[model samples]
Target: MRTADFHIEDARGDATVLKLTGDWTTMGLNQAAIRLGESLRGYSIEQVDLSELGRFDTAGALALVQASNFAMPANAFDTRPEAGRIYAMVETLERQSAEPPKRQAPLVRIFSKIGHGVHDAAAEILLSMAFLGRLMGATGFAFRHPGAIRWPAWVSQAERSGLDALPIIAVTNFFIGAVIAFLGADLLTQFGAGVFTVQLVAVAVLRELGVLITAILLAGRSSSSFAAEIGSMRMSQEVDAMQVMGVNPFQALVIPRLAAMVVMVPLLTFVGMVSGFLGGMLVVWSQLDYGPAFFIQRVSEDPDMGTHLMVGLVKAPVFAVVIAAIGCRQGMAVAGDVESLGRRVTAAVVQAIFAIIALDAVFALIFLELNL
Candidate 1:
């Protein structure tokens, strides 16, 4: 046949010829694909012929095969002798385009992950130790450079984190003491030991309730606030900007808050303890006909002031570190944007609270063992 234009006509019935002309390259193939797709949309395009195709290339061949694949029933065009080569090429393309099956990690790769886990654990431990060391170094530096202790910032944190939280601590501790007394009186009344309810309430409040309740309250109040404040500053790019301006984020942002909490939580705990004892005394006097003397005598007799003070005071420093660590970590980790900052702040608060509780348990176990 002479090299000329190609035409597709129906194989059966009154055939209408559709012309395919010009050099068949990528654009020609695209045009052919578009025309075939458009014609097939509204009409029942059952069959097409490319026998007159001239100057056809692989692109044109592929385009014809794609059109045939979509317009015809499966395996109907595959059986044609002229389409056998095109079908084979399409099969190879389909196979090559398919995603390869995934393989599970082998024993070696699994062991390698395990090894990395160990290294990560060790690195975390070292990081924690380094953090503590840095705190100690900062404390020492503050002692040496007393002027560097930003009094205004420290006072601001103390008033906000500790002084402002005072009313809440007092109120909660008072209710807790009242609840303890009421519960103890009811339980001891069966044995005609209602008078000794003061002793029980006093002992529990002084030894455990004071520190525990104060810590829980601070966890909810101060720690969360710290995290949110730090996260906000971080998200606002203030902390990074400080670093750019040659400011140590730790000293400028974190150390003052830590120092304030360390000094103030102990004071706050003492306030809570006093309020709790008074609340118990109130219940005892009203319900059990006992006096304030009874509560004072009972609590003071067994638990030394030094012991109570030492227990709460020691926890203050630890709680301070926990709050600062969580806040600073969350702040430094803040990605840009308000949503990420909010998430980090919430996570920091939750994690810090859980950590404080765990630390409190460990402290309780150790102190009980030490007879403190």
Candidate 2:
């Protein structure tokens, strides 16, 4: 077949003519279009002559149409019906491309995005609240009919979220307490009150650090576990199956996990407190040359032990509920995809930790007001 070729014929007025020749086919059409396009740049083409064209294909037709800027007048290709039809089609596309895109002001776009985010956040909060209400109602129902409670599931979750987690909690809190004691001893030594490190460690670990550490750890570990477990169940449609079988998913799936957290967090907190205290005692003994017996005596003599311990333990149940609720809520929100499952699981941990810290702050304010 003949190779495609085109040339701009010199014109006298504002209108120019592109004269195409040879076979207008895919082979060598792109190069022809490029050369023609560059040569025609300084001229405005209002017409095209395809009478010299021997043959034509879609690609070459499109290339010629593009090179002409789709401005070929209606009568320009009337002598060649094929060229006219192809030019008409490409002209429609060119007209469509000429339309401007609708755009919003930058400030308006920013506000629109902010409004969408706020709306989504509010919807999430309302959904979480609804989940919490459902869980609470299910819990009350279980309480009223103790036989309906899933004791086996609750025990298994306790083992997973509590007993199995003890070593990490204990080890973590121990080092934390030791660090605090070391710092307190160094600071207090400046005032010749290094002996008071015992009281400081005791009060800090028992009243705040111990429970907070346990709660944070559980938020990362157990909360994520809960989300993943329930999320998998959701993905596999097991939760829906439970509902179809007349089982209340909240009671069957969530209440047991919630009960596990409620029962175990305080216990873990107590263990963490003792572990941290022991760690502090070890640090005091080694760094300050203080005996364990003397340290124990100092801690026991602290009159605020009862109030501090009570204050710490009182927050455990609330923290447990919040963690469980966040975990289960995110699990229920999981869509039918692995990415969604992973995202919800991460959100569960983060939201639980945030809620724990915020609630702790509120509790602190309330206790401060009450002078507790």
Candidate 3:
């Protein structure tokens, strides 16, 4: 059969008529609709003669209805029952599209956003405190029953979070130390006290940068890994299985990680300190032509070495607790989806880093007050 087509009868006046002929099927309806719409655009369509249309499907009906701008009256077209029903459906859809959407006031929207953020922050803080409490309880229980401690898991985590991370940590601290030495030497040279560069590197690396860099690296490495691993377990229902089998997820999953961080972070901090010192030594020897023996002599003579080293190491355990807790807490918060796992892992790393920096600032204030 011939494809459906339409032609304008008289489109110049206020009342226009469209005469459709042949088979009005899907094959030709789209083009037919375009042509019909163009012809009817200049005038108000008053009549549609579909009596000559041989056969039409729902597709054709929709095309004609849309081309008429959903304003075609019921009596305007002599359409088959199927086409009439299709026309009615399109009309309903058009009415829905034309509806004006409801909008909120700008102030209301701003306040709603602020309220949601505050609520989310409060909820996150509460959840973190609850997780911290659980971890402390687990640690106490392990201490009471030494046999319950997962030594193998703890050892394994230590290797991953400590030994394996040494290279990058060393490289990072080394470069930072070198940069500090260079800056210090350049500034102090003007005052003819270039030797004080050793003092600057020693104080900064031993007291702050070493431990801070180590914690930040671990926050990125171990925290993200912990979140992803635990989230995967949750996704696979392994955590649920552990619960069903009477295994405490906290003891099995969280405790070993917490213990590993507590023990290894201090060791990593020490490594960072040594690496940074070596870096400073290299910079001093190469750039300032200072001897290693002289640099060591100056560093050892500094009264703040003992105090700064002690203060820096002291922060390691606390930083470890925050990093591990944030990681595992975010992991436990994961929902049952890959997207949720990814989001939780990202949030875990970000939160861990922020917490470490904030806690470091707090520690700095405490030490300053203590005059250490």
Pick out the ten consecutive residues of candidate 3 with the lowest summed lDDT: 73-82
* lDDT (tens digit, per residue) of candidate 2 on 264-372: 9999999999999989999999999999999988877878888999999999999999889899999999999999999999999999999999998999999999999
TM-score of each: 0.67, 0.83, 0.88
All candidates' lDDT scores?
Answer: 0.72, 0.89, 0.89
TM value for model 3: 0.88
Give the clash total for candidate 3: 0
Model 1: ten consecutive residues of lowest lDDT: 70-79
Sort every candidate by TM-score, greatest first.
3, 2, 1
- The predictions' CA RMSDs to the true structure, in order, are 9.7, 3.9, 3.1
Question: Cα deviation of 211 in candidate 1 (Å)?
Answer: 1.5
Q: Assess candidate 1 and give its TM-score to the true structure.
A: 0.67
Can you write out model 1's per-residue Cα lDDT over 1-372, one digit (the tens) per residue?
A: 233234555655764444555545554554556566555544454444444444555565566556544444343333345544655676568547867767657987899889999997697557657766776777788889888878898889989988998999999889888999999998999999997897777666776787778877787777767767777788788988998998777787678888887888778878887888888889988988888887677666764655766776678678767876766666666677888878767776776778888998898899999988
| Candidate 2 ranges beyond 4 A from true positions | 1-42, 47-69, 73-103
Best by TM-score: 3
lDDT of 3 by residue, 171-223 (tens): 99999899999999989999999999999999999999999999999999999
